[model samples]
Target: MTITALRTPRRLVRVRKAVTRRFARALTGDAGMSTVEYAVGTIAAAAFGAVLYTVVSGDSIPDALGGIIERALNTRV
Candidate 1:
């Protein structure tokens, strides 16, 4: 075999090993969200819930929902 042919397989093997190592590292890495991220997410979710509750608990929403329910109940089957 020629020198180039021998070097070709060795280079391919080295490249394959490097790619495998990188892929394995990427899979097993501790690349998750941190505590600060969790706190921010929690605060954001709470604020959203509060806003949603305030909107739903307003007088107009309840009155509209009650009117809908009354109309539905009064509809003849």
Candidate 2:
């Protein structure tokens, strides 16, 4: 390609400026959540964690885990 082809012209410069302005506005725009959204997200995450913890530490899980450990310890290794 020629050097002129690689060089940006006025139209390309205008286009680049437009795109940069658009991107700037988009970045600074309210595309994210407010404080209430953050609070809600935190609460949801905490609730999900609690549920996971409850399911993992349930009676059947503990019994199964204790049986595995007991067998492992009693094995004549």
Clashing pairs counted in every model: 0, 0
lDDT of each: 0.96, 0.93
Candidate 1's TM-score reads 0.60
Global Cα RMSD, each model: 4.0, 4.8
Query: How far out, in Å, is residue 77 in model 1?
Result: 3.3
Clashing pairs in 2: none
Candidate 1 accuracy as lDDT: 0.96
Model 1 Cα lDDT, one tens digit per residue, 1-77: 89999999999999999999999999999888899999999999999999999999999999999999999999998
Candidate 2 to truth, TM: 0.52
Question: How far off is residue 25 in model 1, in Å?
Answer: 4.1
The estimated TM-scores of all candidates read 0.60, 0.52
Candidate 1 segments exceeding 4 Å error: 1-22
Instruction: Give the per-residue lDDT of model 2 (tens digit) for 8-66.
Output: 68669999999999999999999789999999999999999999999898898889999
The candidate that achieves the highest lDDT relative to the unseen native structure: 1
lDDT, candidate 2, residue 50?
100
